[model samples]
Target: MTTWTYAELAPDFRYWLREGLPVGLPGVVAVSLDGGGHYARRFEDAPPALTVEATDFLLPLQPPVLYGDAQGLAVRLTDTGRAFDDCEVVFQAESPGFMLWTIHTGPLADANHVVRVPALPDGRAIRMISGVEVTCIENRDFADPTRPERTAVGASRR
Candidate 1:
């Protein structure tokens, strides 16, 4: 049984969504929620290993749903839209916050392909994609086992 929290697995999940799934990675898949209150599996190469439906939620507005099955686990966010298939997502996580780096490789490659989303505890998780930055309110603090005092937030070249 694995005991990794959403904070710990978030970066890996984002990477898988941004990039393609590696050969043998067997963990939870992450899905972003759209404004319509529906959960979508964005990655074409690797879809959600588990079955996740919006009816699973107790309420229509509730978000950040987690589902696990024989295949693995999945976390679906209710406020974000589908991740762009042509962008490469890189993320860094720490206590209290996490950052997502998206690199666009499509026709917009000539434009600013790099965008960052900085998440703060009890603050806003910014979503920057396609030249638009949307802010979503976060309810809880991100907790990382490695660092208890402060969570690191930044983007680095991969």
Candidate 2:
């Protein structure tokens, strides 16, 4: 399974996320696709692909919170543009309610994000006020097999 430490996103990422810039955080997001299905092992396997890459952004948040059972991050877009097209994650289950924890990003949403995170409280969804327009969610199964924790946000390591 995957084990990691909780670190904040880089300063630039945090800024975009907070300000709602859609250009996306500038950086290379790499994950393993193969090798043995173990810790940091996906860097090897291909084809049936052990790694997945995406144009990732740092969603905004006030401050992060880690519940006794789980941890979560929330963000809203600064740019008032088209809604998100689609978001895909590695923990494949068709919809939001499987073994994978869920993050919800949508339109005209206020930090009044109780609908998506019905399991949690309304104030629980992370939020930021900025220039662009977007919504972002990041959920964690604190004890899952695939959360990327090795990457550092800025030049500094926490």
Candidate 3:
């Protein structure tokens, strides 16, 4: 339940995917945080004089909601300011080396889900917990994407 705010369209504002990676498609998100956390994006229309791409920071009272599975773990937002119904929660397999996680959640937000990474070579150790597609993981409608291949970083979830 961490809430972070940042300018969506600012030069100084840098998120996780700073290298301009295609998170999904054209509507790729610049910032990627712990699965199911509040994200603040700056709009392009922002005034240019604004040097600091961020302002009025407000962190959530509760800490980040940690989980181990392939479900919606982060908040998803659309370019039009609308959030999707469900977002995918991609987590690193709990196993050592590269292993596939047994996911049971639908797209991530519809129902409770789980991801179990077995033991392998480069196990789920340095990977970050994240989700794709859903927005606002608070007491609201949540959705998610199921792809261990994405969250595990270098492992195959198959």
Candidate 4:
């Protein structure tokens, strides 16, 4: 298991996806996307700003999450503190790439969610890793406003 803390939300964060994940696998990814609302209950002194936990393969601890196979996984990180209320875990599928998971994190809205990127630059990058091997990496223009054409990973073709 690996934990991503709020402090480590910079530079880069690394986690593993299932090994031997198919390139064209459909609805093959799951994640825990929280708006850091859980941390609000932590009244203890020096409460953690944020933290995300996942298996070595990147499967969420609080499954099963949902994402349409056709959606894209877009993550946006910010320093401005904000509030994130929606939180849950489920398995989802839509198309191949439409916009599966769109993460927006900040100090105020401290977030605890899994992102699919080695280095987060503002909010524009989609990369995939199957097990210990990197399967593919693609950089898209943030201004294009076009969703990706494939989901990140999957066990087998659906």
Please provide, for model 1 over 1-158, each residue's C-alpha lDDT reduced to its tens digit, 9 standing for 90 to 100: 11111212344343333333544432223333443222222222333354655453212222233334443322333323322223222333333345444333332212223333333456543332212222221111222222111111122212
Q: Candidate 2: where is the Cα deviation over 4 Å?
A: 1-59, 64-98, 116-158
Give per-residue CA lDDT, model 4, range 1-158, as digits (tens).
22221221123432334422223222112222242111111111233243324321222122212232234442322212322332222223233343333322221234333433223354444433221111111111111223221111212112
lDDT of 2 by residue, 39-123 (tens): 2211111223234333232323222221222344332222233222222111122122333433434332233222222334443
How accurate locally is residue 110 in candidate 2, as Cα lDDT from 0 to 100? Answer: 38
RMSD of 2: 17.9
Clashes (backbone N, CA, C under 3 Å), per candidate, total 1, 17, 37, 32
Q: Against the true structure, whose TM-score is highest?
A: 3
Provide the RMSD of all predictions against the true structure, rounded to 1 decimal. Answer: 19.3, 17.9, 13.3, 18.0
Q: 94-132 in candidate 3: lDDT tens per residue?
A: 233443333322333322332333334544353443322
Misplaced by over 4 Å in model 4 are 1-68, 74-104, 108-127, 130-158
User: Which 10-residue window in model 1 sums to the lowest lDDT?
Assistant: 148-157
lDDT of model 2 at residue 2? 32
Q: How far does residue 140 in candidate 4 sit from its true spot (Å)?
A: 30
Predicted structure 2: lDDT: 0.26
lDDT assessment of candidate 1: 0.30
TM-score of 4: 0.16
